[model samples]
Target: MTATTLDAVTPAGAAARRPVSGTVHSWDLSTGVDGPGSRFVTFLSGCPLQCLYCQNPDTLRMRNGRRVAADEIVAEAAKYRRFIRAAGGGATISGGEPLLQPVFAGELFHRFKHELGYHTALDTSGYLGARATDALLRDVDLVLLDIKSWDRDTYRKVTGRSLEPTLDFARRLADLGKEVWVRFVLVPGLTDDPANIERVAAFAASLGNVSRVDVLPFHKLGEAKWAALGMDFALRDTPSPTPREVAEAREIFASQGLTAV
Candidate 1:
């Protein structure tokens, strides 16, 4: 999508200011899942990985999204400020992989935090964490980092990407003292290996900055999306983790001294 320039006044005379724009799939309001309370969540389009259980296959490509400027998104968020504030909530910029358009993500967070005086969170996989500049991170109050797997081989199999980058990003965030909430999807037979779960738990606990760990049970909510997109639903037969299995996984993280939910 092409960038649009906005008119601005300079000390010398009228000037042009180009705000960062990005391909946004859509946005929504949600509570208890996205962040602290209620949140105006913007879902940007485009991603590098092809996970087997991706729920939003329709958001996998930039072409499927509408081009929107950071300002436009910020304006829309302002409309929800009152309600969100009343709920002790804020704003979140989620993806298909937000860091894929780091500049646009940064601009949105900067405005959400500074301009709107709201708490801001970035929902990302950390695969493109290197793209997130310190300036961009400065405005982010929280990061919801998805760590798919602790096993290198399993990670690549799940995301079609190496696990090293995510690990590196986690360490970087730790060093930066950034508050992070780790999200782990519990897929039976795939990610439920107790050993793998232990490794993840150990790593997250060591981070020191990890405030919460969300053990998300796997589901087929996206199977229909895959069918609609004409893509094979590889995990169609894979059942959701049983309640017992989910409890066991959460216990693993809790054993690590992390507040797992």
Candidate 2:
């Protein structure tokens, strides 16, 4: 739904013209889950993966979003700037894969971190991590990286994408010494394999830059959204992981000498 307009004269014809625009699903304020504290989270639209457990199925496509300029998003966040700062939270660019609109995401980070002096985070699957420029990473204070599954085929079954790209991106983030919080969903039948959990734990531990690991238990909260979108909810019968399973998965990460919660 978002389109960039180029001048007929030249690419840099207008200084007043917005430098970047993107498809935005929505924005909200959240605490505890998104980042360090309270966060002004902007959910950009468009994702390459078709993760069966994706909660925001409505954000799967670009056309389903509203076209907005980066300035508009930042200005909205400015209204909550004082409150966010007081809570020890900041701005986070989340998505249907934030890297899908790298330029727009980068601009948001620049404005939020440099201009507003707030902590910035990117919540991404890292499927398109290659799209992130060095400058963009420089502005990001934390990365909420989703490592869906560790087994290659299981990853594909869960997300319909290759697992290597996410791993490659994690390594890249490690090399940059960027702060990261690795997020993994515990699906009772699909992703709870002990070996898979161990692989994910080991990989995250090897990163050396990972600060925390969040073992999120999967639920059916998004089934209605999928039903509304007329899409198949493949994991409808899948149950949430039991407390013991969740605790055990967390223990796997702890065994790797990584903090898991």
User: Highest lDDT, which number?
Assistant: 2
Q: Residues 114-149, candidate 2, lDDT per residue (tens digit)?
A: 778899999999999998989889999999999999
Q: At residue 150, give the lDDT of candidate 1.
A: 92
The residue-by-residue lDDT of candidate 1 on 38-155, one tens digit each, is 9999998888989998999888887778988777898999999889999999999897988887777877887888778889999999998998888888889999999999988889
Model 1 residue 47 lDDT score: 89
**Pairs with backbone N, CA or C atoms under 3 Å apart (clashes), candidate 1:** none
Q: How far does residue 190 in candidate 2 sit from its true spot (Å)?
A: 1.0
Give per-residue lDDT, candidate 1, residue 21: 71
lDDT of candidate 2 vs native?
0.89
Worst 10 residues of 1 by lDDT: 5-14
Off by over 4 Å in 2: 2-17
TM-score of each: 0.94, 0.94
